[model samples]
Target chain A: MTQEKPTVVLLTADGVPEPADLAEVRDLTDVRVCTAGTLADTLPGAEILLVWDIFSGALSDAWHAADSLRWIHVAAAGVDALLFDELRESDVLVTNARGVFDGPIAEYVLACVLAHDKRLHETEAFQRAGQWRHRETIRVAGRRALVVGTGGIGRATARLLRAVGMDVRGAGRRERDDDEDFGHVVDSADLAAHLREVDHLVMVAPLTEATRGMLGAPELAALPDGAHVINVGRGELVDQDALTAELATGRLSAHLDVVVVEPLPVGDPLWTLEGAHISPHMSGDVEGWRDTLSAQFLTHLRTWLGGDEPAPAVDKGRGYVSG
Target chain B: MTQEKPTVVLLTADGVPEPADLAEVRDLTDVRVCTAGTLADTLPGAEILLVWDIFSGALSDAWHAADSLRWIHVAAAGVDALLFDELRESDVLVTNARGVFDGPIAEYVLACVLAHDKRLHETEAFQRAGQWRHRETIRVAGRRALVVGTGGIGRATARLLRAVGMDVRGAGRRERDDDEDFGHVVDSADLAAHLREVDHLVMVAPLTEATRGMLGAPELAALPDGAHVINVGRGELVDQDALTAELATGRLSAHLDVVVVEPLPVGDPLWTLEGAHISPHMSGDVEGWRDTLSAQFLTHLRTWLGGDEPAPAVDKGRGYVSG
Candidate 1:
């Protein structure tokens, strides 16, 4: 007899499964994949709780109360939302979509770097105005770049930048971790010091005790004039007020993929910074992205179910820190 | 017995050299670096003609007419300015600041690809306008890109894009006499055919008779609709009217570093293409760029005086083709 298909509960809020995904769900009669937009209902008989965007805010008490919540697979790459006090204390196992975004996000970082270095926006404006101004730009090659959070995103960015002849240095909690050594990996404490010497700084770290408000007035001020900043990590990790103020003075420039108050309120000064390149938190939204995410989730699920140590298990001590 | 330092003719309309540049130009004695700006005054007794802004249309005549001009070095990469009927017949050995721009221009192409793929502009607009509209974009990874022109710029762009997980195909004229064969290099003829299959098409070609008007209406229409177009090559190579029309419809998008009529002109409709990115021809401009160019020129000058074939020569057939 064929073994019974395992049960799975997909809590992807506002996500409508495509026909192909539905077919995967219906393949196993024993597998009942149910979605919950809000965390109101407990996952009944769910061996796997796929917390897509369903776990964005504080989770419902009933979610933790459910004994069936043995495993939580976050659809998003960053899992700080699920790493709340209650969830962190649980004995439940958690895995994230680490490899899914490494390349796309890294591409985003490079794109921002190119856009800033090349004065793309100004060029576009000049083109529209029918003006041919022979402007100048700096070459990214051979420049120093500091990537905070030397995880998948940092690793990918470092590799891409290094391939272009950039002197890439990656910063994390510590550099001696034999478990990971990417680019010219350095320690987080030394990141500010590194910024002084580097030309570009890309933040891909999580918003946690060690990193929240890490790039505040002092840090933003630390960057050399004309130094550029791109943040693909959490917005709260940077002090927006300080960033905008610094940019206003033309000391530092920035490209923000995430904002402290996304859809930044109208009339916000950030909209006016000539050097600022803003995107709506979309560094990882690539076409067919859902499929990539699902495939990654399926692969990880198989490994976890086989009792193999999960490829990207949660490091509760470090949270989710990568690009 | 020291050979008199070469008298350099700074062939630019505006003869201003930065202090730092003057310091480096010390190798030339009496440093008679005259500016041959006016059409009639092609520096007399000038052994070396440093052609800056050689793209200014009239330099071809000046270059060919300089009776004493022995070595002609162009500030810009494309020697099309030096390739007219007159100069082609002259024996003046032509050199260019070729390698100075290879990495910088390549970085510009990569930047355009990134900006388009990430939708940085739209996102920034939405963010500044306080509008939250989520959209998915194409991932450069796992996609095929055809980088035309397998010279220095082409090679640099391909390497960086490849590092981003892009399947890159490089194409150039594989001549029998040429020793450099970039692996996976295709012949130029294959480019027109390759358009239909590529996701991104980056043009770094020079403005030769074979290349001018190469990416015109028919070629632009032949490309798969969504393919992102980047041209750091000669503006004439791409039919400007065709590109503007295609970009207007948003069926195709482009980042143009060089355009046919730059300083586009006041009120030119070309400035209004929703998908077209036009800058004031600044891709090759970088902080302290002149220094790099001068440094490169000096290296090649040393090599030439030492009785060695310069590391690369200007391809008389291709005009400004590099090492």
Candidate 2:
């Protein structure tokens, strides 16, 4: 006899299945799709929670109603926004869409690095003004890059940067002399000590209590003059005020995919800063990414349905996927 | 026993040695620096000509005075502008700053490709407007690129693009399956037939009778809609009028570092086109490039003075550095 399908609460941004894969997911499980407004009402007795909206913190607010939430699967690489104290203390297992983002995010980071070195932004601006100003550009090859975070995304970034001949290093929770991706991994706690030699400071670390505001004024100040800071992780991973001040002086540049505030408040200094390059939190969301994320979630859902745990379980205490 | 230093005519844009190396070249040899207007006077008895101004076609006008010319070392890669019927038929040896430009131009092309794929121009535009509009981006890794020329710059471009996981092919003078840089090389004579599948059509071919205006209406029309054309070679390699028309329609985009007109004239439609990215022919002119080029010429000069042939001599008949 076939057992009854477990109910799945899918917290989506628009309360609709965007890609066809999400609809297919509905056929396999008792799926109840809802937006943030209806998340609390839909949470009770659902054995599985799929955080498709990604950055929504609705789950934390509706935690009192999670009567049977045995598993929570976030369709994103970072679990910072979704994790809460109550959920971390709970027995519920958390899994994230990890491998799906590695390649796209790494490619984005490399693109930013190349664009900065080649002065593409200036080229675009000059094109707009009909100016044919010729200028010298820096080479990406042999330049030093320090990737903060030793997770899948950071490792992928390191490999891609190294592939193009950039000298790559990493900063993680612990220091290491031998890392396959980053030849020498420095401790993130001591990030300022190593910033002096970095040409590109790439922040891809997951935002946790330990990593929040990790690149504060001290670390930003420690970076060499004319350094480029690329943040594809989270806005909280950096001190935005400090970065803005540095960029204002034209001593440093930044390619920020995330900001401290979503929709970045009107008249914000970063939007007008000459050295700041802002994108709308899309370092990893390449074309067909929604479909890929949904497919990844389905793979994990299937494994869970077959009486097996998902492959990459997030370390609740650490607040990310731990190797 | 001291040997007499060669009389070198250095055709410069500003008639000054901007880099100190050129000043050093003056001390070592009988160096005569002259601008375009004074080239004819300076060319009379010079045994060696250093075309440091790069794109100046003044040599053709001064050919009547090239009585003692034996070797010409261009400080730039493309020798199309400097090559004349008289020079090609004469015994003058031509060498270029070939290896110096290969890597920098390759890096620039990759930068343009990545910038185009990631919608960096749009991101900059959005930031200027202080709008945080999120958009999906194309992934460069799985995309297909067709690099025209198969010379040093083309080979370097192919390698760099492939390093970022792009599917690369080459369009050269002839078709070959066993080519090292590009596994499969297509003949440029059949360029139109092969362009339909290409996502990025990179033009790095040397400008010759066979290559000038090679990518005309037919080739541009054959490209898939929304395809990007990147030209780091001589602008004559493509039909700019046809490109402008295609770019106007938004059916195709372009990253043009070299234009048919250097300053691109006032009120030129290309400058205002939405899809046209224009740079001032400075793709390969990276930081300290002048020093590198000067050092290369000095090395070649030393080799020639020691009674040895300078390496990688340009095939004057074909108008570029050749195998």
What DockQ does predicted model 1 obtain?
Answer: 0.61
Q: Candidate 1: what's its TM-score on chain B?
A: 0.88
Which candidate's DockQ is highest? 2
Clash number for model 2? 0
After superposition, which runs of candidate 2 have C-alpha atoms over 4 Å from their true positions?
A: A15-19, B15-19, B23-27
lDDT by residue (B31-92, candidate 2, tens digit) is 89788899899988789998888878899998999999999999888888888889999999
The per-model DockQ list reads: 0.61, 0.87
Candidate 1 residue-wise lDDT, B1-323, digit = tens = 86766566665566446434555566543344334456436455666766665555565546535667677777777887666766666676778777777777777777887777778767766655666677887777777888888777787778777766778887777623322333466677645665888778888888788788888887788889788888888788888888888888888888777778765666656677678777766677688887777777767667766766555668676576544
Model 1 TM-score on chain A? 0.88
Q: Considering just chain B, what TM-score does every model have?
A: 0.88, 0.96
Each candidate's fnat, in order? Answer: 0.79, 0.91
Q: How displaced is residue A39 in candidate 2, in Å? A: 2.2
TM-scores, each model vs. reference: 0.88, 0.98
Residues forming the 10-long window of minimal summed lDDT in candidate 1 chain B: B174-183
